[model samples]
Target: MTQDAQKDSSTYWKKSRVELRAAGFDPDRTAKTTAVVTIASAWTNAHRCNNRVRGIADLLVELLAERGGQGLVVGAPAVSDALTQGTPTAGYSLVSRDVVADCFEIGHYAHHGDAMIVISGCDKTGAAALMPLARTNAFGLVLYPGTSSPGKVSFEPWAAKGTNLTIMDYAEGRAAQEAGRISAAELVELERNVMPGSGTCGAMFTANTMSTTAEAIGMMLPRGASHPADYDAASDIHADVRAQARASVEALYRLMEAGIRPRDIMTLRAFENAITTVYAMGGSTNMYLHLLAIARAAEVPLTIERIQEIGERVPLISNLQPHGPYAMTSLHAIGGVPVVMKELLRAGLLHGDVMTVTGRTLAENLAATPTLEEIGKQDIVRPVGQPVAPANNHISVLRGNIAPESCVLKLSGKTLEKGEFRGTARVFDSEADTMKAIRAGEIKPGTVIVVRNVGPVGGPGMPEMVMLTIQLQGRGLGEDVALITDGRFSGVSHGILIGHISPEAARGGPIAAVRDGDTIVIDPGQRTLNVDLSDAEIAKRMAEWRAPDPAGRLRPGSVHDKYVRLVSSAHYGCVV
Candidate 1:
């Protein structure tokens, strides 16, 4: 090893020793075993969260320990148990930042052993755990709890149960209404019929997208991307977890033997590859920010522009979630993320030479796992030469007076108007306000919905305001309504939703200057978001706008606030 590598290894080992001691372990006498840390979202309240945490824990304890010299350490058993029991614990306490911090803490404690495995399958938790794992550069593997299959599980029970029926309910209700007068009981039953079993929603939400992206990036084993809860495959969840943990350890040992650094496994190219998959899968908009955070942790420069540039060439292929008709279970049955990677590689969209945890080039991994005919027939993954959309259709970075640092928009399935639009800017400072306006019929069709104060530094975490788009659609103005936000949208979000407007209102982005009835135009075909105002008008407004006091931000005086401050102060990709 080079002198610097040797020093780095030594420092890491020392840090591990310190952490282990702090965690109530005897550094000198503790068994030299790999430690696997699993982070799950609060379980009981969210069925998918419960199953994922339980499934991963069950898998790790069984698999790694059987490998002879490995020990499993779950980061938050109390939290896991609470989630499984369905009891409300602390609110907002189980955020992704906490999970990531735990992973780092546990990984450091266990670094002296052999390797680390991360088992997570929630939106923030998955991203958080993986980010720190990348930084540890420890031999790491991720086990994603799969989504439940729609065919096998019955949503009837939940539908029969109760709650505020969403747009889907309304859609079904409309059908019912058209047929005849339906009782309240009938409507409740119908809603439950559509949301069966105990799993995360099948759409391409943050959890599912992160899992698929993890597999695409090589942090997960081939064909490890999806397993529906109702399928026999879900029954083997433990086996899957164990296999992943074992493979992770082996991969780590191979890297150590080859004198490969963590950077070798997690590289700039790999980050780009993962981000591209995130776009293609119609993954989470959170990924745009999460990718930036992960890249920072790995000491890579990943900007909004870089992500948009990559998206320009990578088409949205996964016919899942908010953009398409299928769910994650269908994607898994159709060959999962490996198939996606294979196609991307074939299309020359992904860098085939990138190193993976599997100890093989990406090309080799795909070749070894040919898509089964049954799965291929389902079209889970688009063929390399014939993709769902041409390369780079899923995401775009936009720049205008509104977003100086660059903003992002997912372009897949989006129909843009050829001519410029001049409409009054209907500004809503928060998602709640926007929704209230929509429901109250105050928002007219062809309105520019400016959702401000929800950027990275603004929302604090830049939460996706997906409901705004859904509400707009419900109002029969899906195409006519344009959403301009400093926040983001879910991967399932489509149709003229512009997100990640940088230099957010809190930081004086042009979006902050937009008032109700100000003329705003969006020309996606030309890649422009112009407000009909002169430079002087914009400058004067900029001067007059007062940024919100930092104290007013969400999660104020919390760890999230601290993270925001830390990341904003550090290099762009250093959060991990």
Candidate 2:
């Protein structure tokens, strides 16, 4: 690990024990390792979320090889720019979990990998790695590059540095600019500094939300969730970063020694435990998507109905933005996600008997943490009795005439004002059209904006769109207006946003048949979303419906075309 002490100029993987040991590798093993652990990472410069991946991957290689095992890197790419409208990509955006997971699966067999140390720095990459980790069912451990530090940006008085800003601030700035509260110049400056550095945005968005939930589910090490990518040199997060990465590598090695695997930890009970935690944290809707994909790979029987049941029982508890007043950095300041899980476990909300990467039970991990009582008193994570939502079940599945396969709704924003909504359908064929209407002041209150043909098969990777939700909120319509789509949403997004409408428009779902001005009702309290129409009328509409063309105008033999042909519906997790 310290150096390449010896080399076979002709071949790799033919080193003698002496050669390995001369490099300071420790060959004395208490138990034999089956094979080199695969270190999977979607390493790219396209996003800061992937910034720490290479460093961490390198550290893992050294740790694994030093401990009488081998390690190698498998990289994948998922590129999208949050700064753009609806977060469009410059190119090559239709990458799939199947491809990313296949890298690990193929490597698991090709190299006889016995365990895994996977890296997920972005939305799809994280979810992608989870599936292969589950499929391998080996002694696997997941660790994020960690969330990004918040940038100090705002246009309140001048283009002065204000509080921490994430991607959500882009909408806030644009909203302020249009309202005449700030100028276009200020909006431009705010956008420039909104995203400070790499790592997931400093909110409970998809990446960080899944990172936090991964810890709660017992696949990640304690205190590994919300550390900043690059913080002050004196900050605790930067003090011993490599040591932390090495700790996970060691944990995976030990897990392999103990003959433990992902399926053992990601069981039905553990998946339930993770769902309960996601509800408590007001986490991303993507968790629903990724969790399903992981369940299928792990062969766990989890369903939308089952998730709705968990939401009914678990209350939204974490106060992190855009769901509440705090950010992910604050969560780390208060002892990270392990402390949060300890609180949930104390409330009997988590299955404490579940296996973990540390070769200990979930209960044991909590018990080992001496700071639980000390940090349990913080406002970062509220007590169960006083949660973010006044009521329980901030996330649930809606079933009726429109979404018989069920659509999901986010009911946990701190500014949320209603539990139910009724409005006329204002349909749009594409995100660009929907954004144009909202910006032009054409979308009004009492409107259910339906943007169809954006599901996994339709968008051809289900390109996430919290932009519409955020745009409405910018126009002061977060609660007054409602939006439903077959696309995905950014986790930081708030409002009466119903995403992942299953049996997507591309597949002739009822959402494709909806017409403008049709009465669309979304009542989370009743657990239903419906269009007021006779079954015969709805059938007639569907019978004559035609799938819309791809928004990206995908070409044949392209990545998007492949996703369209092979991807599953949002109902079954859009898995391939």
Q: In candidate 1, what are the lDDT values of residues 422-505, reduced to their tens digit? A: 567888877777767876778777788898886656665555666566566545666787888877665546667778776677
Candidates' lDDT values, in order? 0.60, 0.74
**Candidate 2 lDDT over residue span 472-563, tens digit each:** 77778877888999887878678888889988888888988899999998877788999989999999998898777665468887877877
Number of backbone-clashing residue pairs for each candidate, in the order shown: 19, 3
**lDDT, model 2:** 0.74
The local lDDT score (0 to 100) that residue 481 gets in candidate 1 is 76
State which candidate has the highest TM-score.
2
- Each candidate's TM vs. the true structure? 0.80, 0.89
- The list of candidate 1 runs beyond 4 A from truth reads 1-47, 74-95, 98-103, 110-113, 151-187, 229-261, 371-376, 417-422, 549-556, 560-564, 567-576
